[model samples]
Target: MKNSGEELHFRMDLGDSIEAREQSMISFYKRQRVDWTAPLTCTLEGDAAIGDGVKRHCLSSVMSKLQFGFEWKIGAGKTLLFEGEKDHLVPAASQVFVDSDLFVVAGRMIGHSFLHNGPCLTGLSQAVIHVLGGGMPEMASIDIEDCCDTDVREAVELLKGSAELTADQKRSIQSLASGWDLPGVTEENRRWLTEKILFHAVLSRSKGQVKQLRKGLKETQVLDLVTKRPDTLPLLFPRSCAVLYSPQLLLERIIWPAESDSGDETDDTSLEEKCRISGFLREYIENASSQCLQELLKFWHGWEVPPKELYVEVVHGLMPRSSTCMETLRLPSHYISYDAFREALNAAISSVPTGFGLV
Candidate 1:
């Protein structure tokens, strides 16, 4: 993705890459002109056994760190992000988020990923994206589903679901409201309380965190474009539709190996065998659920971000493996039937706990 034959190098380890990435970004930010447009060329340390770079293998590994909160090397680590309703990602509200400077790190990641044509942070709550893009908290269009905290969601539901509340429920609601300096639950203000609770759960609670995110985005200069053109939000933080990995999409992106130009009949049988295995993959993709589609994409190319093409090769091996650096899937042609192929691919995909590396 680097147009000028230029790439930046950083050392990373799978376990400590987040810390490594933080330092790398910190170094970049220290530069007088933080160039957001340049592509990242990363190489992993401690992965001498795994090795890095297919151009993408290490880059994907590092960029993958941008999506979630880093479990700090110090005490009481944080899971910077959590899933909300419909599995959209929303920032978690914790002092640790601010303390770790996750907002700053995440913004740089988003911008770098975007510019490098790597993964985009998909399925982010639209409301949160609005806030990160500099929309006011009060102006954020949030849904009850966007609130990831169970207690808060439940409290809001109870307030809205029934007029009468049990004593315990009432106290719970009051305590939650009190934490945010909102009014106690009363017959006359149920509507107001429900609204405020929803607001508090989604935006108010993360006010400082989101503020830092905006500051971070400004450092990347992505905020400058987002504020200037609201439509660009979908590119950085895409909605569900923009990220749907349909069977056809995957099938189309695949770059099948070219047939040998020589008229070697031996190559004919091997090409047939490869296509047969590919048939299994095609059928598997055809019926896969959205989650499975993502798993396959991740297995094939590191993160689920769609690439222009995914190079596929049939190999004489016992198992399937992918190189995100080269955007290639080395499929072992050992399986003779569809079920065997499916099972192998499934196991291979599951082995990667994170989308980028093997477990």
Candidate 2:
């Protein structure tokens, strides 16, 4: 039965990315005849050309939305979808997510995207990657930082290296532990309790989701590839979300506006400003920190996964703008110095911290 609550179309709302993709996956993923190798075709509801580029954009958009928007909550309504540091994230356990078949959608979506040469889901913890690649849960190395639940973290932190817990503290620790169906915390079982909580929070809770994801990969035939090669897992699910590019590397990716072949009188002056601004940009990127680079990429192409090239344009304006869909970066050609250029670039990226990909 088709889900009538939300209609699936190429011109779907970015905010409704989850619901839209979910409907489409549920409709198609189960069909054994669905060709994973077939090229994806997409178009807006209205008149528009449906091409591979739009298909690429669609896949990229889905995973990015899934990363930040489709998150579950923990204590105080804190998010617990992808836990651990910014660079290293593990899929957090959520009964709500599993029940909703979201993990299944995620797994299938990633496999579909991979078959089409789309984006990889970044920042996955090495521990989860091991299991995705067929490693046993017990042998997989776990970490304290990998736990997303603040309640668990606090309880474990309090119990670790403490001579004794105050009566109130012990009760608090025991209370939360009981919620996860864990036994009472004792001095003798403190280590056992901590390990159990961490494992449960990170893996045991998310086993079903992982299973569904692997099943999706199997349906897409990607699981067979990974199971046989075992080395291709990291390529599909890398550890870091940001790809650090050097100044030279980024500059090389710029597809600078070509000089006019016709002898237009304004061409010479336009080319001069383009050259000057490009120099200014090169200098700024040379000194740019990792955060700045990541932000710039988001501002340029919507996501940190660098495209093969970025189209650059020098426009007659005071601020910079980007069309993520077009992979184009438009800059004002009025800057006189590197410092002015750098300041404006920083301000532009910071202005839309939440939506760097938007114009």
Candidate 3:
């Protein structure tokens, strides 16, 4: 490989793999097949046309190899000369890609190195760019901290306007955010913090989980946990609530574990344990972290219950139903059975056409 002025000169020596843009190939020699590939198609699934004159290709099956927007397979003992525009080669060993969305611009990206394949980028402007992150390469380090800060600040702004937050809840969140030394924090740590803040704020108003959050706020240890280690706040809620914060889990189909018919006892049992709700009281508590409570209510209204009655049952279930009679038949008697409460709740939600969503 050689460089002269604005032109780049390279030799595809025997058995070499050279990737260049589809239209960038100026001249080539020897019998080597030059394959044109779609931008980031190797890692991304689904068909998306990148731009004019770009070929449509599927993501390659190979795991370790990177599918550049285009590729050239040079045969053994073949020597080829290629010339194109000047390009800056970002050394993979020293530098890491961070937030490709900010750096990789369509039509501007000639080629990327084979050293890493992060998230696949698409022709769509909103496509996620897999940001490379490892070492600070020359001229690339200045924007990382700034970008992280901006993203975090934007998420915080969203949190402040969230409808679920009570007056006190908003003040509590603000106190934590104010204490966070955003500028002084490391780039990676900032990303983590940003995720935690957004997840907690969004789930703050989740139905089944709100009571737990209030409970935690009252305990000195839990309050300390909330202020100093906000990341663990989701844990104080039920697993059903905590799992909602996980991006990976939420991406899957939304359904309680007991609702699945996969027939895999082990997996089903595991999911049930993670999201166990045996009765109305437990169900209300467990589902507190769900973001789709309204949607879930709609489902219940359509098939399970009338919304107004479901709402009433939920209110009664939350209160303590069991009381010890000072001289009862020497055994505790229940005011409401779990089955009756669940059935009444379901009937209530199903009867309301609009449900209690607005109420």
Candidate 4:
């Protein structure tokens, strides 16, 4: 692969075999820009030599033969692309890899490797290899159908037949469809279309008429979330989109490391701290009204929690506007024990003119 400007762009020559890590090729075309930005595209005609499943068994057999001391599992898929044209090709560069460090991509566990030196572990002598690297990476998936031109055409036709749209909405959709010149509808484009259609329909209606439409849209969204089960919702609409609904899931994902072993002797000190904090918060909110959650949702619906400095600046700037501004701005809870909160309150209180000198 060669770097073309800001991004790496490489083309696979049609009928030329480029050995990728595994399953990295999204859809091969004969020397074409991937989407629109990729500088080079390559196409390989035949299947991988090892394939995904066969590689796994082969790797397992080799590792068992070596008696490597750790249980290993291969990740979903990774691609390693080797340098060569259709006629002349060679294996990619290979390096020695620890058993724990080396995992299979796709189903195939095939790699050009040998037992070397002291470890008596499987090692890559000379070959290009790719596998899921360490640490969690944010992932998103688009269906194969979503990328097909036929699917886009059908979706466009369905939109054309939709009778619920206003004249303006229909026109806007037509305009959007005309400009979607790409062969297939990408996930981004699909999301845009979905959002735009709803947006137009909502805006075109009067206030009362929009309510039912909004409700319907919300129901459909919830159904999609429940049925399809996305890890995270696409940010289709700024204020109206449904995000991941479970705080527990978020907490576990953010706090607890994935693909790790936990032994009785191994203590998660951070987890203990988090548990303590969570317990206190749970106890504090036990007597809180149900409306507390609703109020929080309402407050954050159209706004994000600002950074501490920005929040302090905004509070300080606004405090001087009215003598009773503090009284007017009633928090859901009148009291909270936090240093920044206290500081902001003190600043606001101090800014209000008082006959007695400022504390």
How does each model score on TM-score?
0.77, 0.71, 0.17, 0.16
Tens digit of lDDT per residue, candidate 2, span 46-109? 2232444445455656666555653323455444445567545766566776776666667777
Residue 169, model 1, lDDT: 88
* Model 1 agreement with the true structure over 278-354: per-residue lDDT tens digits: 77777898999887998788777766777898887776777887776677887887788888888888988886543
Q: RMSD for all candidates, in order, please.
A: 4.5, 6.2, 26.4, 25.9
Instruction: Identify the runs in model 4 with alpha carbons over 4 angstroms from their true place.
Output: 1-241, 244-249, 252-274, 278-359
**Model 3 misplaced regions, further than 4 Å:** 1-7, 11-172, 179-359
Q: Is candidate 1 or candidate 4 better by TM-score?
A: 1
Q: What's the residue-level lDDT of 155 in candidate 3?
A: 47
* lDDT of the candidates, in the order given: 0.70, 0.69, 0.26, 0.26
**Model 2 Cα shift for residue 30 (angstroms):** 8.9
Model 4, span 227-270: residue lDDT tens: 24332222211111122133332223222222221443343334
Residue-wise C-alpha lDDT for candidate 3, range 1-359, written one tens digit per residue: 11222321222221222333222222321112222121221211121212210111111111112212223434433221111111211111101111221112111121211111211221210101111211122212221112223444454554535245456644544565655432322323444555555433222212122222222232213334334655533333212222233222322323333433346443323333233233443454344344343323333222111122332111113322211111000111122455554554444433222222111
The weakest ten consecutive residues by lDDT in model 4 span 125-134
Q: RMSD to the native, candidate 1?
A: 4.5
